[model samples]
Target: MNSGAKDRPSTSFSGVIRQNFATKISLCLLMALTIVVGANYGWRRGLLVVVGGLLGVALYYSSFGFTSAWRLLVFERRGAGVQAQLVMLAIAVTLFFPLLAVGEVFGQSLQGFVNPVSVTVALGAFLFGIGMQLAGGCASGTLFSVGGGDSRTLLTLFSFITGATVVTFHLPWWKTLPNLGAISLVDQFGWIVALALSLCVFTALFVLVGKFSTRETRSLVDDGPVDWLRSPWPLLWGAVALALLNATVLVLSGRPWGITGAFSKWGGHALHAVGIDLSSYPYWAEYDFGRSLLGDVPTTTSLGIILGAVASAGLLGKFNPTLRISKRGAITAIVGGLMMGYGGRLAFGCNIGALFGGIASGSLHGWLWLVCGFVGSIFGVFLRKQLGDGPYRNTQPQVEAAKP
Candidate 1:
């Protein structure tokens, strides 16, 4: 133990014993749950769960989060996170387009999350941006935080589900907004051309951010032999890993990784369990509503993420959960989560689903989502300043980690 261990009274015998017992019990339950579910389903679903768990591990260790990256860029003009995103996008587009064109990765069919360029996408992404700021996390951020033992995120998750469920009832009206339907660069142009175009955009972003960046933030990544198991991974390495994981999702699931859609589904199921009928909803009818309400790929993957986050946080000695939060903060979390859920439905995805996955797949809607989402984030930042804590309101200044 560290020299200061004795100085911290919170690590008392009772507390330590209780926490350790809880952690062990939680781990056992999670493992048993995964095994039972996988055995009942199939190997493919099991693998997907593993992938989600691994993704959670990667996200937690890396701190390669989109919400903070955007927040830092908009508020502080810090572009390191933005640069990392561009790197990830560039790598994803390069790999994804080529593989998608081939139509199979080891015999698994591949597809992308292509959506229409529409008014809803623009408005939806903007709303989602503001929600993420207010909520203190995006879709992926929420799930991982919950896994990492954040009690606040549980509220965010609940609100998100509620908001998503509400959107289903009004989706028909939202869909009526003018749309161009799904458009893909790879479909219009060849994979080679699409890749080139994507790279050019990434290069432009790189140059623009580079010109404006005053200080390059060093990542917390260590290059030691056991660094892979460590927290605070290098930004670039995290970005690369996320890109590969997302591409792997496309190959395995025949679609890019999405977060909020499953949330909405789960929310709907919750309603149904209480004797509410959702079959009449147009959104549910478009897909196999009843069957989907039962666990699907996305939902299982999400479940995996929470447990994975839990495992990672526990291993790192960071699994601290507290119910202490100001009333104002709690309200903000609920509202933020609601906005994310509703906006994600309107936009066809959240930050991970639309912005990251969409753009990587060469969809124009994805680009629109970013522009609109960023605009919303600007408003969110302003609202955060007025109503609650803004991203820049931190008392401690951020110190960049030493370069590897």
Candidate 2:
């Protein structure tokens, strides 16, 4: 431990200050941006940006990840991460159901992210699952990880943007595909029944998955004192914070939290800048793509997430950026990112927008996303093994021995 310390700066007051330089810088930038947003956009939008920031902080501090959680469950049979997700879903659905049922809150009309159960959705979600494993992160995961200075994910993000944009050219074809249309559980059944059913599903998943974990393992949730200022947060805290923040988003934005929509928007803007006309595309025309950049809630909130992640990484003294990626890793990241971006668009969203937000909003499509995505993830795990990626490649199946 002493040797490790010697390899880096000391943990004294001055050293601590030195380590947090990035944190201070990120906070200042975040504040300036927030002020700008508040001045131009409404205070409500500004507040949403803050909520996005808090989400980023929670995500980074807890290292709460959808991609790795699925991979761990598929490859190692470790279900703790997936279990934490269940807890998050449980909390979110509880809050979302009643609010969605109300329909109107503080003069804001509320709605869930219900989308069609279609062939496109099924294939898209499966591809997204595979992309996440290969790229090493999901939509939110990609944003936060890139913001936290994982340079490799930067490559992935660029590819993601490109892929999302490329798919717009093919959207007309996909729309022609058979779609069952949107199904909202809250609308179909009463909110009470929807909530009960959601809870039961969550409970069933929790129990069924728990049986696979024969030994205790460290997970996002930790059982001990946590230094909120700098240390990693307990996963449970992250889960609750995410749930509450998502609920707050629904109240403020009239919809639950989403991330990938902004990615597509950004991609559109980039293409437009390059003198490409996408306005003729049905998808872009439908959304009125001529709007000013960052004029929407999703874009601003997504930006906030990245900045917030940067701040969190700074606070934790982990904001080291590097572009040192292996050739194979780079190839995989690009390919995976493209798949995630394209698939997410087809599926109507990524893990956050589709799975978390969808389910919490009582959308049947969310459940479909979960099932299909997990199946894709199982294949992804094997693919990763074939690519020589890590423990999945070398390690044999065995329970971790209990530590003495």
**Winner by lDDT:** 2
The collision pairs in model 1 are none
Candidate 1 residue runs with Cα over 4 Å from true position: 1-30, 220-226, 286-294, 393-404
RMSD for all candidates, in order, please.
4.0, 3.5
TM-score of 1: 0.89
Question: What lDDT is reached at residue 342 by model 1?
Answer: 97
- TM-scores, in order shown? 0.89, 0.92
Error of 2 at 321 (Å): 0.8
lDDT of 2 by residue, 48-73 (tens): 87998898899988878888777767
In angstroms, what RMSD does candidate 1 have relative to the true structure? 4.0
Clash pairs detected, candidate 2: none
Best model per TM-score: 2
Model 2, residue 180: C-alpha shift (Å)? 1.9
For residues 1-404, write the lDDT of model 1, one tens digit per residue.
Answer: 12222212235566565446545765675677567666877656566777787778788777777777777666566788888889999999988888888887776788788889999999999999999888888898899889877778899999999998899899899888898888999999989999998899899998898777665455333456545654456777778888988887787777888888898888877887798877777777665545743257778778777877777776655666778777878988999999999999999999888998898888999999999998898888778768846444443223211111
